[model samples]
Target: MADSDQSSTDSPVDSREDSIQDSKLDKFSEDEETLITMMFNLVGERWSLIAGRIPGRTAEEIKKYWTSKYSSSE
Candidate 1:
């Protein structure tokens, strides 16, 4: 039925949104934070490379976290 087709189409999008939300909620473990800091020092804003060093972390998330935690407010 059309309803079933619509639900199927919506399922993947819903799951993707759920994953995004989950990632946003996920906190960086201490090891992850330390690794990110060390990697940033080594790589200097090459976020994708930094992300490669940290498991389950996206470049965007690492970049956002670093900027919020480390960037100067002034």
Candidate 2:
């Protein structure tokens, strides 16, 4: 009973975070791939600099996206 109550309260916070991240990513999608490409080319893959231009996305997320996109497939 106590465990379930704690889980219920904690779940909403995690759900909210997921929704926030999704919304942020959605904003990036609106600008198209070209904008991101230009930023990356000029900024030199520096997430901190890129994040300034794109609101809501963090530096880490920027790096992660770049890695996943350019990573070599085996």
What is the C-alpha lDDT profile of model 1 across 1-74, one tens digit per residue?
A: 99999989898999999888666735889899989989888879999999998877789888888887888878
Candidate 1 residue-pair clash tally: 0
| Window of ten residues with lowest summed lDDT in model 1 | 18-27
Which regions in candidate 1 have their CA more than 4 angstroms from the true location? 1-26
TM-score of 1: 0.67
lDDT of 2 at 33: 49
Residue runs of model 2 more than 4 Å from their true location after superposition: 1-4, 15-27, 30-32
lDDT of 1 at 16: 96
lDDT of each: 0.86, 0.73
Model 2 over residues 1-74: C-alpha lDDT tens digits?
99999988998999999888755554558473465678889978787888777766678777766676677687
